[model samples]
Target: MPDTFQRLYELIDTPRFAQGGVPRITTRKSAEDFAPRDEGLDVLLINTPVREWSYPNVLPIGQGYVAAGAIMDGHRLTRLDLNADRRVPISTLDPGYDAWLFARLDEALAGEPDVIGIGGIITQYAQIKKICAYCKDKLPDVPIVLGGGVASAMPDFMLKHLPVDYVSQHEGELTFSEILHRIEMGASMQGVAGVTYYETDSHGERTAIRRNPPRRTMTAEQLGHMPWPLRHLWDIENTYRVNPVGHLNQGRKWNQGAPESGGKFSAEMIASRGCPYTCEYCFSDYLGTAYRSRPPADVVREMEYLHYEYGVEYIEVLDDLMLTSYKWALEFYAELHKSGLPKRGVEWGGTCRTNILANDIVRAAREGRGNMLELGHDAGLRRVAYGVETGSPTILKVIDKSGQTPATIKTAVQETVRVLGYASCSFMFGSPGETAETIRETVDLCIEMDYRPEVFFFTTAYPGTVFWQLALDKGLIRKSVDGTVGPADDGIIERYLMGLGEQGDAVRTNFSDLPDDVLLQLTNQAAQDLNSHNSHRHPYQDGAPNSIVRDATHATI
Candidate 1:
């Protein structure tokens, strides 16, 4: 869930994929060249697919990056991203499909790896268990270990319900290493601090709920000790295609003049882990509550590496809150400027608060080479949504997002426009206390901001957010979108099956207390008003990155 690989790479003496400390392996089709034979290899495979319904998004692609990096550190990984290989015939949610998945597993194991480790973000537990069962059945001797964001969130539930041999809780880098070392030494798993295991009672029935005591949370320094995620393990260039709604795939056409225009040399880099903002709708709070940042020097070095090796032109810091500290931002930008890298102007973007747009930060972001920003202005009725579930400040307070408000948000938006000439604003619909009128206010706010020639929009609530919880509690979510509620786990598929476009109800909100037509009309009108500027197209060379051509470049106050 967090960037574990980035930290490890930071600790490395040299961060090259082909360097000596890392494992040597080929990703994608290259691995297939080896004759199929079980080498009796012991591997630790982590699956990141969050849910069964999420299968369409999983494929070995992303996991391969992590696994490949570990393999460079002398670990073997059988990465699985079910989203990538959609052609597989079996259903991921069906426990009966283990036989089918195992066939591929066996081919990979090929007697090469003696053990297989699996980890994921929780929702995939059912599917992961089926795979675990298959491993036990085929290679009964191999150990199956599980750990991930989900393991940390629901360790007890995972231990009890799944066939997973061990569940590593909290940050997995250290624990995973400990587990692997113990395995290599053939040590007992009983004393591992982050592990949970089961032992049969004298009655021969599953009885005891055994667990290792809690351990300390990992620090950024500690995290920096691991290997950089092995990007070589994945088909990095092709990963954009794995997701149906992946932004890269949206409106993408290959071989077109617009498509060929690659954006600046900026690379998406992780400067820190954990978000300080506790918006209930985020999983970050569920996994980590504190904020941590990598040392600035380490970050600058990575940038230097990017410039020398990859010809990267700019940087996109992928932190949840890159602007959490003004001092950190200033220092990082200053250090980066001195890295002796190419002076190619760079553009960066991230989620930040309007409060951070102080003159100094704006100057650095605008003239200092950082441009483009994403501000989360969840609702215009921030207050009511907090208490009465309206966009009132009171409502925002109730939802624990009091930091967002129209005044402060407006200042932030204006600051971006003042300094960078443009920025993006995100408003979440279906929030508590929300109604058509409140939504219209938000729409009106977007229209007002539209004059700056920025972006505006809404996104459906994905499962696992606090917003979804509220939706469920409000009975706004139901089974079989005929607008009826039912009692059942609803299997994750049904929970997310609002069927949006597929059911001809894409524009309909399940929050039935409000008139459906009214809600749709307001939402549509807001979108229409916001998009009014899209027709007055800015003259941009087709493939240019959206950031560089905008006024945000020299708009700083």
Candidate 2:
């Protein structure tokens, strides 16, 4: 909270204001605060801190926090469950929070954990930097290992910039556990695959950096059997300020009935890993494109634990692709049914692709009691909104999205109405080959599909994707971010790029046929025509961090 800093500012400024001059008093660390600290503690894992301004949710818990569960692969989604078991003691903490939150960090750090693992995403760079800087300042000898989406996205960037000791990309289960083991046993990281670190100068500035080739992606079996996340490692309940019963929520509403403690408990989980199909704009597209599915039994078991143990009556699956394999869907349905987990276990939804939703697949997904499937703008158009990125097949082919032809896309969107019961669609305005004629083609396509426009996402080039290279070649993104510091407000770049991803003005386009002003007008026209459906549901009603989600739908599930 800002209360602490605000009060200090007042105390110092009050004196200066009395004399009608600016306060020249400087604030320095107290003797006790700046005292020498021990860096030879045990293991400490951190989930970088967050605030409401940075992350808008019904609750203020940070995103990418589920790294513990991720390290366990898709099998476990919450950490509180992991700490209950005999596992590694790298307790996760979000100490960069309020005063009370700092207390929780103090308790976790009281053990003086020597190895610290910090989990973060791209948008949390500034916060992660602040946390790592503080940790190094206090415990200079301890090794701070950074991992998570941002690390996975750009391992070299983190190694070159942040004051971290080590960084790991991609799946961290094998590598992180190995790193921890070596540190505990007094070994070296020279042979560790998927690790990067900097050789720093005496002043803590990076002098040299070395990164190893990433380890191969985990096998399907490896992902399914990993241990659960160590949620017990952190005081999450108090840290997130969770008020499950009633709080501002984004996206779909989950009717979890009534919360045991007025909706005080909730969680987000991932049931699968990677996506089968490749889209140029996906952040992780640059990483290998192969996808993996967790065993259904393992997925259900995680759900069972959360529903019963954490009192998480509602859950949301945050997966790359929640529905793909028909065989897996059938097995998953059987597991959920046979397990006899309460209705709470199935109250969820996840993103699906256009080609994954066959009749049998949809039928199997609907077997759950409280499940739902939400489609991304570039998803399988069944009951969800069709992703009509552009009307022109020429543009589609140019962007290497020939998979979404007029026939295939229209048929899917039309069939979805009966199979899933509602229709929403997403469109993109600017890309490599967008032109006036292409824009018209998109508008006409929306008319044909009867698309209920949800939101228009003006796409950008994320670092690991093919689009990133294209953007670079075309001068869209000019400079490399390795040595450069990002905006002081880490969220600025993400917010500016996505521009309220659900609904807002599009970001700058790199289209060839039209200027940005013309592209804007064409996009607006297409949006109006697509959203012209009389029954178009409000997009905000189906945004993120909802009450519950499912792989398919509420009526069928």
Candidate 3:
């Protein structure tokens, strides 16, 4: 065995030992695990395996929400979290990994569900494609539905290429329930809002595609009233055991700070959905630009459950932009403090914007002794990551990071470091007009703030973002001379999506004006400079000297 796999096995015993050292083949739990109602449609929700090496697996909360909505509307649901069932180390690197995944899928389909729904992000495009094809072959008559960001972003392309019968667009809880209701009633998908389906001929040949009107974004009240995620369906214990801390809190001292709690285990949750900002590189607009958050009380209730039931000592809030509304942030912190989770040793982290953090500091100064950071610490906010994507003003405008300038970025980082003990800032290279000088500015900004730079990512053009369209317009995403990129050119798009799963620090596609080699060299040099500058820093948790501890960084736009 390779040293990496051997070490992982020795450390965690994650891989099962079998004859000839092959990992055991594990399948989803049998249908007997869930009792389906006779009157409702039998819906199977498949949580396809993501790139596990990219980050540790968490309960698929997005699919959990979908399952919650289905059950609420009188539908029988069976969930298959393929990401959780792997019994092998470095499974994706193994040649038989795809076959093993298919075997698990086949076993899950043994009941022959009435309808199948697959949810994943764009990076899982290849895996999802294989899954959809396998399902079509095995259960030819069963209708397949696709949801989540991947389907919502490029509904037409997905409908034309994949074997999906319908693409459930944004905020899938309501739209998915409506899809199930229609399916149960044997109704046409014509007027179902927030969906993309095909119009078929008499012989069931797809003739054209019909995209229904977009659904209105859900309100905060509606989000609060939605069912709590069906976390019971997943192996929460195994998840906690195998990967205790999420990418955001990897090397933080808090992971080991709470010795009184015995040991630390982590889980991820989202307090809000949809980002209000329109950063050109992001595809969050697929769910609409309205920023809605669940009630603070409701959010705290869930946290309490995780704490008392699952012993989750750490939480990673996966909000797109957690600090969009300062009023909402304050309310959440107040509720969290009132719940006393912090006293019980629960610490959470989330992504934040520099403009919001800077403005919050200003408000704190005006209100009292500028104890906002201290108050948050008391409420269990351990880490706050800011997306200072670029230091150059020109690149900032190009990426449409509204209200963020170099001055604001500096102020936010310096203030966060002074008040919170440490600050985390993530930077990206290879914007549309990126140059060596812009890269230098970003590096200089990092040095000036005395913050150790995490990984620097190349700006990737995901399918539904403005960057994707720019790549197409600039002939980066190629098409035929006739100016049509259809199913025939599926390979072109598929290759690009596959490339997205590669290491982020490496150049994927050079959107910058600089040559590819030059861009790579600059990015590497910037990483080294930042690391060398902060080499002496040490991790600080409670009442320790503030410094940026080395932590694993993941790409976030």
Candidate 4:
């Protein structure tokens, strides 16, 4: 969110500003009054820190260098992705962490910035209260704005609680600009699009209003025109050491030297904005449904720049599909082949819909080795899961996704194997009406498939998805996460497995009770079983933490 805001501010300087998520990893840290740049006071972004679950370094939480690169690029209009813990383990701190964040915020407040922006994610809702308390403590005089996925998805909840100066729901760029403009010009925050805030006349009681901000979708061409991200504004370099994932090992160095040997110099390139698939358990739909693409030439041009200017050897096409259109994909590969700019070579990969697989697309994907293809096989037991929610049709209708049926998935897999030789198949186990039997059915179907594929037991519940909202509304899950799924060390795998597998059955039979140790044992056993059967490599073992993660007591887990 800060990255986005910073980029936007650079483009228009419209009294708008962006910041980053607050660090929640330790209690020793504290927030203070922010320092001022030439433009204005710095906005401190805060969020929950990771202290749990150590596995799968893929798809890392991008921060620091990655964010810096994005800032250097025009892609980021408003900067965010400050704390790069992708699968952040859930952990809680005594009031100290909050106090620190508040202290830092107080310091920023002392500078009397035009407006303070508070960015929150669904997982960080509980932690946000502390941020609010600190903001009020130090800068009660300044206005605070809350925005981002968590706030937008549940505006009513944020408005009711939390000490936010204003909640900017939905896409916040313009709404934030309007709010900032109002604050700077001494105008009323009324009519600021997509914002939820307090009303002065109403005695500081929280108020909710629907402000219609213009939808300012940037084209790939237009993106080139935006000011590069302001990397200098963030403590990016420090966060890289903290990111659990290994995104850094993949991308190349900026010295224009040789590619990092063991791990390729890979970077995620968002060729297009939005996903065409609306899988119930996926996040693509929430990001935005509007499908837009960057010109292949422009993208290739950037690739060359990265290759020559910065010795990037591999580029991961982070787009929903690198081969959405066969012609486009082929042309992109062919251009790179002809450019000879990166004569050394480059490799890359991205998510693809199995149903859209084409021979040409597969052939193009073969351009560079170590390239991976991610296919969203949400459910192996399509029929059962599709039956429970009955939203499959709606999803298909809305997102126009292919491969809802077993036959299509098989074909897609076959095509992937034929073209890419290897692929990552994502699988979701539990859903609204899912049971052990149904889940087994899905697993069984995967075991039956001829292709050896990578698989993950993707949980059905999470924020920013139709399934999560449905689960919450149906009371399928507890309203608040008790570090069970939120914290890094909360035993996410154990919690989910104990609820759905053999141990879960055992616990149910034994008075519906299960110990954490039992659950952990069962979860590990299940993971081992699944790993052994599917021939899928264990993500936990690959580049896993070599040492124990340190705790406050000097003990490592």
Candidate 5:
């Protein structure tokens, strides 16, 4: 066996593994033996800190879904949102930063949770590791469960590395609830669907990993019945005051062209799940290949709740693709018009495909008011962002951007800006076939659109994406064993994940034919060129720290 797999074997060979039972891997340091509580399980769900500087600190909607499911199953849920805690210093350089995080964890553990759950995206691997290690050390007997993109993408890697008992794969709402139910009943997790767990032998030693069958994506009816995300668990007012919905109003200028709406607060909502297209670099399939949406009236009702409860003036629909079908968009917008939020000065924005935006009917709807694609000067549709990954037609095909070409991208962005007065476009560099000429084409297209774009300097090959497999095929990602074509076990994979968090916009791997230095220089120059066109440049675009600062002195812990 390779050294990495050997290390993994040793790691699992612990006292916890020896304490085998229905829910194995629970060995308490204290004298008391582990036992399932008769009453409801005290579940603690943590929303790990994302790179707050790059992204806004919105409500933990994903965790909220999981929490809602657990609550419905008679489990007590306590949420710890590390991202929304302004008391914690933002600077890792601060001396008390690590101590502060530990202290916060200690406070959260005061409830003595029966099972601890944590989650984040692939870029938050390092932070998730810190949280898992801390929780395991503090409560040795308590089971730790991980979910979200990190666990769904690389279940085996996370199971081998982190001190997690189980990984809730893919859509976690149903899976996590079932896991809790099984544990409450003191039943084995062997047949739990959409979960990855370790199966131990009679001697209580872990023999192998067992991944249950994937849970099917929720149907439209199921989605509509699903409970609303438990947003009340979070500090909503503070999050709005600090983060302020950056999707449409990044520079707080999205409303500059429209009439002065007195609304100040903001919130986020999602009306749909999954995307129809399987872009090479995206992990959309993790949510399943099918596109599912909630009822239009139900989504509009949630908007009304946010607007009234949180005094929200703007809402950023964070759906992967809100406008999946033309019919869905029309129905959703009709409900929005009926809610009268637009007349009440509540504006919202979401992502849409280039093809959908380029349609004449869609454009006309956007140009007028009281319709789905409303883009009137005082319209509720304040902004629309396009995932125009590249302007190079060759690279477009390379990434499998369905039905989108250079012309369609140009027309959609140009028309959006023509009607909305501004539109957000995102671009990425260093794909499998990226070249110097292709990089220039992307930059030139951004300039032609006359809109500053969010440019990601490196094309990260997130696990479970086609880009990741391509990287492995090209030897950009290497495994521990020689001549083995599988996921890397040797710390290479972990290091790659850590690099994603640490390097930020800096290049981690050169997927393109261009050399590393050449790619970096070209990407940096492209960002500079794009920055030159617009007066206001984003901090990430120029590789600078954002102006938002956290209070370090409030480290009361």
Candidate 6:
């Protein structure tokens, strides 16, 4: 199911909404004033909501500056510490419910664009469908295209059901351009690689969908050549407000002070595509094993543009695996410092394998104004994990976690903490061959790290992984919470979908050596113990964004 839409999927996240979920409301009372319709561009791209960010009490603080743990300072938090850092929603602080986004789309569409493409992964599938429904009624003549991992994986379901006329799959930059051109020229879409479309049968009924072979993996040149939309496309003037949290660096103690004044924003970018490590549960297979990244010069230029043009103070680097090569990382920092954006006083960080955090590389990143990181903490539990997914060495072979071992992981974690100073670890529970001893091993590691905040996840095989195929082959799926497996594929699909779409839901799809109930209990208890640091009291103890259209100065780092 890997498709051209992988890039689109990367830009999307699973926070805020359950997978395959949609907002209860659709279409404002008014639609004629939508802005993007008037942008006069050939194509309009909509990066719909469920964007990865943290929100207050109800929303999970999956990724936030406040997740940075403040020193206990001999101050044990009471019941009310959580609300002390409560952030006002941008919706309430500005316009509500992404109305601003719709407003911009309306303005662009008002300019009479040739085509409109909407992209999101499973997290936003239902939302995408809802938007497509509204778009169909509003812009009946404009050909609507759907692209992203959700489209690639669910082409049939989307193309057949949703109002979208075309679904662009795997690596969409080239395919999307061609799609727009073909639509404009009235050319047949037969040969367009990495696209799926439907033809009308003689009776005017939708026929079987057509798919083209996937295009080659994206290259560094190709990625850079693509419209680097640092300035264009995004409604930055409106949405790129600064974070209320100051300068946004780690070790900055939380302010019990009033939420600060506004006029700020944070931006995200990727200097690269594809992670080098082959963590089996990840969708890296879809990304192509070959890692590709932009030139350090290009990365720095974009950072400069974001900082100067957009007033972006903190930028999050969104590479799943960053710092893969020390030389590449060094070049990146050297370019940044020489380029003087380091002098611009911007802060940046990323989530990547701890193995890449060589002491020198970490030193360079700090020297270049980089701070904060989410390292691959899986390697630290040598006795309990390999790349963070197995307890038994035998299971490592089953999961195909090659090029990694306990010793290597231990060294990686040690080096990361040595340079970076802090780490937030998330690990898998309920893996094949798991046992009480293995679980205790993990607990020991956590304690060794000083209960250095962790999240334990129930392991389930989402589609498009070596793990999924293995589970299917070995019949580890359950029909219901009660662990029923039937003769048909319905339960299997149900279990898989739940795993993919719902992160909070526990899935027990591991081999029979370990029972789901026990696995669930272990993870729950571990999380409870780790969270005694008053997880609620420290909710992203950072700050929120300023204005929806624009406001807020800093965020918790």
Q: lDDT of each structure? A: 0.47, 0.50, 0.71, 0.41, 0.70, 0.49
How far in Å is the alpha carbon of 19 misplaced in model 2?
Answer: 76
Instruction: Report residue 160 deviation for candidate 1 (angstroms).
Output: 4.8
Instruction: Please name the candidate that would achieve the greatest TM-score relative to the true structure.
Output: 3
Pairs of residues clashing in candidate 5? 366-373, 366-375
lDDT of 5 by residue, 361-428 (tens): 45565766333344322437777777887899889999899889887788878777776776677777
lDDT of 1 by residue, 361-423 (tens): 455566654432322111000100011112345435545764566555555666556554455
Stretches of candidate 1 exceeding 4 Å from the true structure: 1-41, 44-74, 78-106, 119-141, 159-163, 185-191, 202-205, 211-214, 224-226, 237-267, 345-347, 358-395, 417-421, 451-512, 515-525, 532-557
- Encode model 6's per-residue lDDT on 1-557: one tens digit a residue: 42322222232233322232312111121111222222123555555544223322111111110111100001111111111122423222243434644554566557554566776556555556666776677788888888766676656656776798898776554566566546645776887777788876778677778876776676675454433432222333443333322223222212222222473355666667766766666665434446888777777777777677667766666566655665676567677768766565676666545334434445656778443222111111101111344333444444556644444445555555555454444566656666767766666666665544434555666555666666767666544333665332754554345334333234446553666555555555665666622222221222421112212433332
TM-scores of the models, in the given order? 0.65, 0.65, 0.84, 0.62, 0.83, 0.67
For model 3, what is the error of residue 542's alpha carbon versus the real structure, in angstroms, after optimal superposition? Answer: 39
Model 5 / residue 316 / CA error / Å: 0.6
Off by over 4 Å in 6: 1-44, 51-53, 56-114, 137-142, 154-163, 202-204, 230-265, 285-289, 358-398, 471-483, 487-502, 508-513, 532-557
TM-score of 3: 0.84
Under the 3 Å rule for N, CA and C atoms, how many clashes does model 1 have?
A: 58
lDDT winner: 3
Per-residue error for 156 in candidate 3, Å, reads 0.5
Residue-by-residue lDDT tens digits, candidate 2, 288-351: 3468887888777777776665566545555666766766765676677677753333344445
Model 5: lDDT to the true structure: 0.70
Sort by lDDT, best first: what order? Answer: 3, 5, 2, 6, 1, 4
**Clash pairs, model 3 backbone:** none
